[model samples]
Target: MSPLPTDAPILPLSQTVSAQRPGDAPALVAALERCRAEDGAFAYSAGREIGTFRIEARTLNELAQRLAGVTAVAAVALETGPIAIQPCWTPGRLAEAEHRLGSADGGTGDFAVVRLRIVPRRSGEGNIFETEFAGPPEIDALNAAVARGVARASAEGVEGEGRIIDTRVVFIDGAFHPKRSTPAGFEEAAIAAMRAACRTAGLRRLEPLMEIEIMAERDHVLPVVNDLATRGGSELRRRLAQKGVAIAAELPLRAFLTYEGDLAALTQARAKIIGEPQLARWAEVRRR
Candidate 1:
């Protein structure tokens, strides 16, 4: 067969603000509190235990600069908005840059600035790619290409081979012209702009995340969960659903060694499973 095209569009995102190893917990908390006091929209997402909070910041840099001044900054956590990230799929040059960015010490030197380049997975194209690097910390002086690289490669996360397919980044660029561009046009143009840049950067698609939700009886939850763990899962979240005593776990979509029918028989039809694309960001699919 003939080779497919590798010219999919790429987008870059720069994290708004970041806080390096703040000194102590109380100080960091204070900085976060200060951020909350400001007025604006802030989006945050962390692990179930980590907990995410968003208040407001007129500008990301303003917030980061303030947070940086905090005493107990351990590792600067960059706001995931339009920041540069690095992963394996990144180009050798970008990879090297990431290394330099991460080499510095947080205390004496700049924060380890890593960049993850994310490439989209076009049909017959190839796998999505992401590259990581380390460097000094900053508010939002990140390059555009690097941010898109991270988003594309992270299209499906690191779990599913090609299941999860959405990693959108909200960027505030250009003006909303009535004849030139509308509000929606501005949004799409932002995505397209990044996508075009991705093509120029020469990055490709990487693995996506998956959600293999399993519905089973209460008694079978343990066994089902165990079986899922036996397989490779980059990140998994488990929760018991309403009725059916359903035990649903967001697992990698690539896991296909076990059969649902057999599992059903083993659990006497009390167990059922289903999987589908967890589309949150398709690099440039949805409207931001």
Candidate 2:
């Protein structure tokens, strides 16, 4: 055997897919170990409670196949959830330079005045809800209203593009009328304020980026490369391998979703490709 070329493509694990099954810790660990031994590039952590298996793989398809194998052996079921692309506007960034303050008033006599703004937060920091409204029952109501506003804004999305994520909704300041403002009034004000803020923030939709690698016969390399180019691939790198040519690129998850079938047709089922999520980047909003 010969050592592989230094520049040969190495598929790095970029995404983690988790599946839960009813099993004991030992059984889950045993199943994962078998998979790890078979799949050279594999990593996972299994827990007893529901047997959560966090499997890291180079592509979503590969992840699914690996999970299927484990589930078959462990008698576990796979649970799937919705995958979403979120829109966001990071405050103080040049992209959001057009962001303007948004405010609104609601309730009889305009008794509840709410001012709010949306700003980006560090990934995994979750959401932070803040308010400068004053004390007790009204303040509590204001807090709940702020939460409702954020949820509504997230659900409605920016111009119906998608849900909002990785942002903070701050109730910068607001007024409450002791007699005229009701809890329902404050809730109405918050919801309206959130809508206003999202409209002015100039939010951009975000999509996950994937780091991908493809290996193809030298004769088919050109066609594969062209196909990737049309799919919006970037940061491309190619090198000669012992068996064929290896190519690597960064592509958006959306663009790569249907690539398996396309690649098969293009290369006559002679090419192999794998990809995993790398990071998220601002994406152009889809026009209806």
**lDDT for every model?**
0.36, 0.58
- Candidate 2 achieves a global lDDT of 0.58
Top TM-score: which candidate number?
2
| Off by more than 4 A, model 1 | 1-206, 234-243, 256-259, 274-288
RMSD to native, candidate 1: 18.8
Task: List candidate 2 stretches off by more than 4 Å.
Answer: 1-110, 121-127, 159-161, 208-213, 217-229, 235-249, 265-268, 275-288
lDDT of 1 by residue, 179-255 (tens): 23222322233334444334455544432223456677778877776666664332245565675554445433233
Error of 1 at 28 (Å): 59
Instruction: Provide the lowest-lDDT 10-residue window in model 1.
Output: 90-99
Clashing pairs in 2: none
